[model samples]
Target chain A: MTEFQAGPLSLSFGRKQVLHEVRTEVLRGGTMTALLGPNGSGKSTFLRAVAGVIRANGPIMLDGMNLARMSVQEKARYCAYMPQLLPPPVRMSVVEVVLLSLRLGGNYVGASAAMERVDAVLASLGIMHLADAMMGELSGGQRQMIGLAQALVRSPKLLLLDEPLSALDPRYQFIVMDALKRETVLRNMVTLVVLHDPAVALRQVDSAMMLRTGRVIASGVVEDIVTPEIMAEAYGVRARIERGSDGAAMVSVEGVV
Target chain B: MKERSNTESVQRALLCRRLLIIALLLSGLIAAVLWNLVCGASHLPLDLLLKALFSGPDDHLEGSAGVILWQLRLPMVLMSAVTGLSLGLAGAEMQTVLDNPLASPFTLGLSAASAFGASLAIILGLYIPGLPSEWSIAGNAFLFSIGSAFLLEMVVRLRGASAETVILFGIAMVFAFQAMVSMLQFVASEDSLQDLVFWTMGSVTRADWTKLTLLSSVFSAVMIWSFRDSLPLTALRFGDDRAAGLGVDVRRVRLAALIRISLLAALAVAFSGTIGFVGLVAPHIARRLVGEDHRLYLPAAALSGGIILCLACLAARTLVPGEVLPVGIMTALVGVPFFLGIVLRREKTE
Candidate 1:
């Protein structure tokens, strides 16, 4: 099993700090960790820092490799980050876009192999039918799924997805999360996801790290740390955690505290 | 099995269509170049033109026809083709890296800066002391255009290589150079002003075998290197942040591309003055024809650019018999209409 550890990470924009002493440890071989926070809580910043897309203080170690020390190209080989905002519509096919990702992602897999890999990732995401469709023609949810496929096609060791379910419908949210879970497990990869839906997080993630005001409030197993008290403290709301019909823990917010 | 074969057949059809488009553009280029060679200020009959091109200099019955073919028209025609090719490729790369369809060598004021350099040399008698007077204008244009490019690079480095920064700085450079060129024209002597105006009008007559060789080498080297980075450049179409997420060093790639863009524009303007339309319109034509794949679009843009310039040169010659018109005027005449049509069509579609 591979372990990814980032400890005491600090990030700032100009003089204002966005992430303060944030830390996380994820074990590979199909482990999905959920990063939960309100707006401006540094969830995206943490992911960006770990992806080596942004500069941050402290070390991010992935299988003993320091991600912070690695070059952009080197870091890309180990990790892929799918941002929240979908790319604007371009005149490229979904398949072409995925192929572009694979080529630039530092793995010069041959044409046939690369195409095959792209097809496989698209199919895994249940988007094989949309492969030939132009990106500009896809809906917002579909575009996000293709973006995920682009990130996954690189076969990265660590996948960081910021608000992957933001644009998805309930059905697609479930489907994409399921696909991500399967892909992560089967590939023995580590994935860090930011999910606004607590119910989805409770059902899909193995562990959870909650943050507030650029600091971690709790970090533990998803079911253990996402109690009513933690939710009230983190979100400043009176809340209850109750089991749903699907046997998943759902956060029920009564009112603002 | 049937589905797989269907897909294969569709792919084959697409490939065939792409090849056909490339072939059509290539034939257009060859035809334009040949037409330019045959018909000029002094018309050579087809037979004489062919003979002058293939036969030894000593074998010609008349030395004048040979001189016209070998010395004046051929070099000018080839120079026009190379200039178009460089600007076309540079424009395509600029648009890709900047992620703005309107971006080009001309838009960035590189050509304007080159014109300023040439005007400075012609009007002020500014020449490198050891260099011949003939080489001075070209050398000065190259130096100034490259200087503008470096200025752009410095701005990008200081302010962050955002597309907005590059574009804003480029627009500033353009206005600054245009004003300088105007001031030079204001103070120039009548003969110097005429010379400066002709240089600005853009002509292929400045090219000889030596300049042609230099242009060819630079164009070939840059094109080859750019081809190697085609994959990364393709990824850049998704915008910089997404490109960075995929492992591309966006700043480094943008800088490298800006340098190449400057070099291409400088070389083109150094020998041929400031031909404007090809740099701005060629890439749009290529994108429309071949979609956004840089591998196909880059070369397609180059070929289209060469064809357009050659046709412009041909028109410049034939439009007024025995009186040569500057190739620069023809490109604007030809390209601006095409550009307007594209804009109109895009408006209708979007």
Candidate 2:
């Protein structure tokens, strides 16, 4: 069964088409599935469509109900979409942003519960020391982590992250992705992430939906479909996909063809 | 958790500051009223003034003092306080909701709209023979104030809906309104032009109990309903997109704030002519005393505004040998130096 229940989605911006005949769904309770694509490949567009920030042609169904049909408050409760992870557009403290996520539901989990959730997410991401920092004061990578911590407070049924790990340095890259993977699995959620590179794809993501020109180039389980042909087609690069002695996946870009 | 505690403490201090402003304002208003009654061109002793107020209807101890206090001074004092209270709080709301420090009703073209309307009434009265000029003047003032508010809102919307951009657009509209008012002035008969000019300068001598009562009621209602949204409005200092992500509907909040501001400003300008500077500078005083928290900023602004206007009116009635200075000029002159001091001091501290 489709984990996502999206229906007949269409979108356009003025005279240009952003999403065309776009349809996607995950297996319920799936792994960190990456929405892989080039620039303007509609990855961010699709993520926002699911979050209902922008109105689109089709209905996104979570567990079979139409998503846009839900009220703004309702959609916010079921899905937490982290868009581009820019430093919060204001001087709000990190704790304020995190607390806001829990408050969005109006369930307004009491102070203790709200703090516990914030503390847990911050600890998981290893950024408890910077809790008091203003969002505008943080480094890009640190801001991205804080952004992730904010989304994690809600523990939604589905998480839509736009380039969740793109700006992160190598040491913290896997750590962030690993935490996302762990949270999705432990919480039994369906997470759709947008990723740019193969390093993130082969190392962390469970499935890949490679898109080009607003169309899906490939989609399947990580090992079966993340082949040299699809990578070359999607990124326009000649690439090598190999299995090492340690039985880990390896991808190298030979060059653009 | 610790930071949350800090926020709460800051909020509490702001509340204390607001209450202090309220206490100070009430005391100042009473003192001004008494001063207006006592220190007139004729120095009536305290005993005679008390007799005039309390004695039997038939036993008239002082005729001029009673006429002066009841008919002239009381109404003017009340009008000054009411107009200031409404305009100041509304200005605070405008600055906060627009997220621009420079926002005020005057900056947003409202005062110019009022001036244009008053100018039109004066210029047209010579040609039109039968219309009640007083009603025409008040009606035109009220209509144009609302029209300017709508125009300001439209320009702001057209400018991409950013708060800062909207305020800039409003400033542009103010210049347009002022240009039209200047054109109207260019053609007026000199005698009528003098009356129009004095109205533009803003005076409270025309005040009556009826206008005072209505303004007080309208401002009090707006302030009460708006208090619940004060913390949320401050949350907007974090920016609207984030505020919305945190459960505030930014557009809805902005619209609500705009309507209240429009209503209050239009009423004040209509009833008391075009008072300026009260809206622009009162919020700065409130912010300095309390801090950036709107929950307190708004009420403190309201009270401080009332005190400033009442004291200015008292000075207008008593100062400069017998002539009454337009309260607007007095406020503008005093407010400029004070605002400059605050700005300079703030620059040093920062």
Candidate 3:
């Protein structure tokens, strides 16, 4: 299994440091980790830094290879990042956009093979029908799914998704999370996703990291990280973890701290 | 499995349609080129034009038809095609890199800067050193256009290479250069002012064999370089962070596109004066025809540009019977209505 380790990543935008010397435990492949934080907690910034979309003062090691030493193209072979924003409604077709990701990532497959891979990814995400649709004509939720398809089409070793469900409906949210889980296991990839909803994190992720004010306040299993004290400290909310009818753990926020 | 095959068929059909559109555009360009050659001030018969074309420029023909075909018509026709291709290709890259549909060589101020350079040469007799007196204006225009592009590149390097920064800076440069040209125009002698006005109107009539060769070579080289980066440029349309996630070095790609735009725009403006609207309209037409896949879009846009300019050249010749209106004015006349149609149609659809 592949191992993804990011450590001591410090990033600054002008005078403000968006990411502190934050570090993560050795996240292994075939599992999903939810990056949980309140607003302005640097969840997106952390993902951008680790994905090498933004420069940060730190080292990222993927399967014992120093990602810092690798070129952007080389690093992309091992990692695919989905930004938080939905893709603007461009005039390109859905399949063309996904194929563009594969091509730009330097995964030069034959045309048939590339189409096959793209088809498989889209089918797995239940968006196969959208392959021929123009992105400009798709709804915001559909565009979000297209973005996910693009990130998964290349099947990189690591997936960094920032709020992949923000524009998704509840139905699509479950669909997307399920597909990401299946893909992560089937491809043996490490997936780190930024999720704002603690309940979703508790239900969907194998582990969770809680951040506040650019610092990682807690990190471990989902149940361990979503505690009352940590929630109070991180989100300024008095919260309780309750068992649902289906016996899944859920975070119920009571009031402000 | 059935759905997958259906989707694949749809994709195949789309590709075929794009190819057909490109074929149609090529044919249209050929027809326009032929029409441009035959319909000048003194219309030559098709047979005589064909005979002169077959004999080539080297053979001395006894009739005026050969001289008119070789010396007068061919250079202007070829110049229209080359300048349109350069501006169209450059505009496609510009729009993609800047992420703005309105972005073009004219929008980026290259033409205005070149016009300013031409004004200086005409008004103050300022010319580039070592150029022959006849070539001094073109040389000065080329140098100044290239200089403006260089300054723009330096600004992009120093500041962030964001699309907004480049476009805003370019718009500022447009106004600045335009103001400079107006200042020069104010102090010019009546004859020099008339000459400057004519030059700014842009004419394919000024084309010569040497300028054609130089622009064609530069265009071919830049086009090859552009096609090499087609995939990355396509990815850039998705936005900068996502393009970076897809392994494109966004800043580097933007800079490279800027350099190519510089060479193409500067050279075209230098040789053909300040032709407008082809760069702005051609890519939109190409996009409407073939979508935004740069692999097809670049060539389609270039072809569209070439056809537009060729038809403009033809119209410039035929519109007033004996008088040749400036081709630049013709493009503006045609382009503004077409541009409005695109905008109005988009409004209705959206």
True contacts kept of each: 0.67, 0.11, 0.79
Model 1 error, position A8 (Å)? 2.9
When only the first chain is scored, the TM-scores of the models are: 0.96, 0.90, 0.96
Residue-wise lDDT of candidate 2 within B141-245, one digit each (tens)? Answer: 657876876676666555557645666677677788778876777777888666766666788887887677777888889998778777567656655544544
Tens digits of lDDT, candidate 1, A87-180: 6687777777787888787667786677678777877888877877888899888888888898888888889998889877888787778889
* Candidate 1 per-residue C-alpha lDDT over B191-285 given as tens digits, one digit per residue, 9 for 90 to 100: 88877777678888767988898889999999998888887788788766678789988878877787788788877887788888798899988
lDDT of each: 0.82, 0.72, 0.86
True contacts kept of 2: 0.11
The CAPRI-style docking tier of model 3 reads high
Candidate achieving higher TM-score, 2 or 3 = 3
The 10 consecutive residues of candidate 3 chain B with the worst lDDT sum are B131-140
Chain B TM-scores, listed for every candidate in order, come to 0.87, 0.80, 0.87
Candidate 2: pairs in clash: A9-A58
Most lDDT-accurate candidate: 3
Sorted by DockQ (best first), the order is: 3, 1, 2
